[model samples]
Target: MRIPFIFIFCLLFSAGKAQEFAISNYDVLWNSQSKNSSESMPVGGGDIGLNVWVEDGDLLFYISRSGLFDENNTLLKVGRVRLRFPQNKLKEGFKQRLNLADGACHISGAQSGLQSDVRIWVDVHKAVIHIDIDHSKATNAQLFFEHWRFEDRATKKKENNQNSWKWAPQGDVKTYADEVGFENGSLYFYHQNKKQTVFDVVVKQQGLESIKDSLFNPLDGRIFGGFLYAKGFVNAGIEEGNYINTPFKAYELKTAKPSKRQQVLIALQTGQHLSPEKLKSETQKLALNSASSAKKDFKNNQRWWASFWNKSYIQIPKTADTTAYQVARNYNLYRYMLACNAYGDYPTKFNGGLFTFDPVFTDSTATFTPDFRNWGGGTHTAQNQRLVYWPMLKAGDADLMKPQFDFYQSILGNAEWRSKFYWGHNGASFTEQIENFGLPNPAEYGWKRPESYDKGMEYNAWLEYEWDTVLEFCQMILDARDYQNFDVKPYLPLIKSSLRFFDEHYQYLAKKRGSKALTADGKLVIYPGSAAETYKMTYNASSTVAALKTVLQNFLQLPNELLNADEKAQWQGMLTRIPEISYRDIDGKTTISPATVWERINNVETPQLYPVFPWKIFGLQKPGLDTAINTYKFDPDALRFRDSKGWKQDNIWAARLGLTDEAVKYTFAKLKNSERRFPAFWGPGFDWTPDHNWGGSGMIGLQEMLLQDVDDKILLFPAWPKDIDVRFKLHAPQQTVVEAEVKNGKANIINVWPESRRKDIIIK
Candidate 1:
């Protein structure tokens, strides 16, 4: 029976108090000020991220914006802002808090009888950062915009990891300087990418120079940066200083007189222009408009954050296990970090996103500038990147998944061109280590190449023939439709092209080796493939087969209007040809195999259990559940390779299989507080500090523990401890939202959207 919309609204509100309790309890409060940038709190929205911290008596923050790639493809920080209240230096009573509800950072300190409060927030509707300062006593303030890139700096040795030329450079790779100046009572800075960038280098290296004009180069003529200003502030000359191991030049601004209240704004702009003067003019205009509408913008920012928090939440009450509660807290904290780039032009990077600090903090040997992260800026490691995006589905953050989708959309033309020029095929063949312009990383493409080798393949051992990771993104695009009613129209081309590559390419490979393109049974032979960078040189990789089968099955489910009869038949035919997942008898129990056969293992990933997690071929109430469980428990490689760090998904698989004990053990291990003061700055674990994939995998595992889908039924507490009291709201397929709670070993359905979905709910 259908419930009235009015009745549903009432039910939703009756359960609102529990959600309120959940979202409000996770705000991070620090009684003392931070000592360095490593202890900073993350605050951002739209496409900007700021690392805010206090040191000695000064308030400081690092400015970072998404898509700020330079000539070397480095995601450079704009600069650091240092603010000092000369007469009101912090001496006693210092507090810094991340107010999760409003998506803002609040910092306050006292000196003798005077006190100052500073609120830093980013505008969700605009690329503007606002800092409002109010003092109990009138005091003069000094602001310094410190930029380390006053002149070109050559990246040597391992420092090259920050760019696309990781471990190998064709020539001297230098991070060019930025233009900085004080003008019209404000400080403005910008980096205009030079005409020649790593994009040009990679194109020439990969033998794509013939189709160079067709390639999409994001670095060409790109300019990014902004200006900072405050009313009643005047230029106070420039200062030079050294911070950690880096030397910087600062443009100083001082208050005209003592003041009790002040407002400062930093407006950022990014675009491709032939003229630097035109770009600066536009940036200044953005700054002026931002100042005029500061009040309205602040209100709108708060409203957006309010809606974001209210969309979904998971709360383990105070009485729950201490470790589990901490995991829940860290979950929200890391989600805040992901939300910083909700509207970015590019996907949130798997390595660091925008909150990475000085490299020395992550590795003492890496004494490079703040721009340095272990992985190259524009290099997308699809294996790690998928982990970052998979959790967004259940969190109801499908809208935030656009940049990632559009990322593939933007690079589709180039991906297809590579297929046509190299293999004479029709489809997009995206590799695992891809550049922003949709080609293999120049270094990973290998400078030491054999003349007779195939031009299409990356000449590296681990990445050779590894092309199926793109299928995960294709699955995400399809799932967006089922989960959120998202219009998958724009992404249809990407999805079809990706599927076509596997269909046509495998046949091409088969014809080269044998008399037939298909096996005796007519299924395409997927030989010389890879199983998640492990089980290399495989025959019929189970990961590839499962991914293709699942994505194809989902693609055909779309309405007839989106897919024509011919297209449907074509996809349906391909679906029929996808081979069944191979299995092995492990310890006398049948379990899914990584592939039909493999020569050797190269990486630590457990792709045999991939079907249990991302592919969903086996798990829960589904057939072959015991077989999948046996693989996780009995496979020697899966046992030896199981981990909870940096892109590891053992916790996710444990939850998917409804193994509550193992799920709790691994999920707690993955989401536990890091050694850093801010708990979510997870690692330089196989990546970089604030490991986004680490946090993303943790989020996926936690959500999987609470809710799961088995056919049409919504299984609640599938892997959750019955004794743990919790309240949560998460997304489900068919445009549904499940809101429920558990208290004292009893499950209660607080509300379910559409009312019809309530019948689908099953407490495990």
Candidate 2:
């Protein structure tokens, strides 16, 4: 592999000239000093720069970045969650402060009956924290978070935390013999397989023996008890979490480590142990065994990440904003965080994200949620969430992409189950809503207005058309993982159900265009459900058209080796009647969603791009390529829309349309806009923290615009604009990797790495 140019690391940033966090707004944002103490520095939320909120009573906190080192310290920062037993509610004999640091950031508020089963930890070099929280908590446990920046008294300036000394906190969580540990630099947190808890607590601090007591808040019942300047967060469950187990996961790629190879051995040894306290004798032996290589490993860790940043990165060449670099880095870093926090089994698709940080409501800025939120999955949200995975797919992050595929698989079943109910047969019918569990949730999660998705509207049944889009992604996961022992056949039932629904549902809409003719003889048009999402709408939506086309095409592409002849022909037949997309001229503007006229659109972009984005039905393929392009261009909002003068949906659709300039504009728009956050992670104008949806899309938009390959042809600057030049490389399916640089509306090839065995660039 060629060495890269930029540096990528787990950064700790602070607004007060200390290391802490990032947010969209770059201006002078302020947060409350924690009631716990005055010594804490405010940490900006990692990516979404979300507004902070301390809820119930999770006032205790200290925010510290994993893998960060203080400039002068040889040891890593090890922040602790030192909570003293409440004096008033305590026994007189002995009030002890529980203070051990090496456990993963877990939520175990000492509930007597509840086992501290959940443990959330950042995977090696990954920012994604794997969560193992209990779904049974009736009273949400309180969380304590703190962020501190070291100011060197001698330099008389805030100390940069990039070089912090790394060490495990001496907390009881680390005392478990089965507690996981890095050999030298790996980031995976493992517990003894036979351990009692699902997670281990990880303690981190900047390694200062003691900071001023002022840093902590004097014990108070309020969320802002800490005097230390820190951020806090609270999660309101998903839109449908009550139906399924509360699923939680974090996203991030491991930081290039100091001693990855060596850590493998150390980790293996750690896996062998059960508890540190019980095996103190063995612990000392292992520490001594690993001491000699510490220095060498640390240096290598920095260099590895530095090499990664050198390749495939976005640098703001020239921006008027003073915090341009911060914003630029924030966007990229958050993408890194997304990758780092991403999981292997489930990408946590719409189940929501891992490091969702915010500040205590009292403090205007910083915070982190110890527990995962309830269920929620949005139609408009899927693409943005999928964006984070685009780069990951090529970065050799196959495991990270699993959750995304699992989500699709789960939904396929959900669509099929709904279809079976609605169609009165073995097929798929999509409802407007779904949760982490693979089931339709109209019974709960109904819109307050209660229309389509919830069965009040006429066209809700057509929502299943969107499932075809999910099928295409399933194909991607199939290719990414080589499909090796993974049994996707089980999911084919859903695919069959979807095709069955579409083939039987579609009707000739060409005969009914507007007015009484729209209803024709008023036969109460049956079948083709609406594309869902809106209240009441028409049958056979452009979205359904795009999706039906996608589904038909996907079945045809499945290798003959993988499918039976009968199944293949059935899919081919469904491709024939693919519905026509409807468009109207609102002063010559062609838009794609359910309504063609192009209004303010309470919903975001048109579903027509289902073929363009998550679905790959129309590319430089068959013919609609130009039509698709025109439709995108004709709509004013296709690339840019002024929602109260603020831009939305532009960042995503631009990339889908291959409009690199538009994509970049939307990207920097979120960055440069005054109302936007300074750190530039991008959020809706309303809140400072990032909506993970948009944050994920930023990565996908940029990736799609830069490089695209269907089967054989790799298009350079396909939709890239003349103003911006991009340099990057991506890994394609079947082991082929593509790297290049584009400038002056042209691309220059850099490199391509092909896995020894892989196939199908663009299938015919």
Which candidate should be chosen as best, given lDDT against the real structure?
1
| CA lDDT scores, all candidates in order | 0.89, 0.36
Which digits, one per residue and each the tens of the lDDT, describe model 1 over residues 1-764? 13347644633564554434546699999988777899988999999999999998899999888899999898889899999998776657888889988899998888878899999999988888999999997888899999999999999999999989999988798999999988877888889998898998888888889889989999999998777878779999988999989999989999999999987889888888746676667777877888888888888988888778777888886667888788989998998899999999999999899899988989999999999998899999999999889888889888889899999999999999989999999999999899998999988999999999999999999999999999999999888777776678989999999999999999999999988999899898998899988899999999999999999998998898999999999999999889889999977999899999999999999999889889998989899999999998999999998889888899999999999999998988989888899999999788999899999999999999999998898999999988888888888887778888888899998778767899999998
Per-residue accuracy of model 2 over 1-764 as CA lDDT, tens digit each: 11122111111111122111122221222222223222121221121111121122222332223111111211111222322212111121211111111112223333233222233332233221222233222222322212121111221111111101111212222111112222222212222222221111100011111321212211111100001110111221211111012122211112231211111111111112334343333433433443444345434433533333332344433332444344345555554545433333235332223332222321232232221112221112343444555556544455456556655555565445444444444555443433333333322222233333423122223333333334445455555543212345555665566567545433332233334322344332323343433312455556656655665665566677667788788676556555466665545544455533221233444555555655555565435666566666765544443332122445555665666566666655543423232233344332223345555555555556655556555555565565554445455543455555545545565444432322323211
Runs in model 1 deviating more than 4 A are 1-22
Worst 10 residues of 2 by lDDT: 222-231
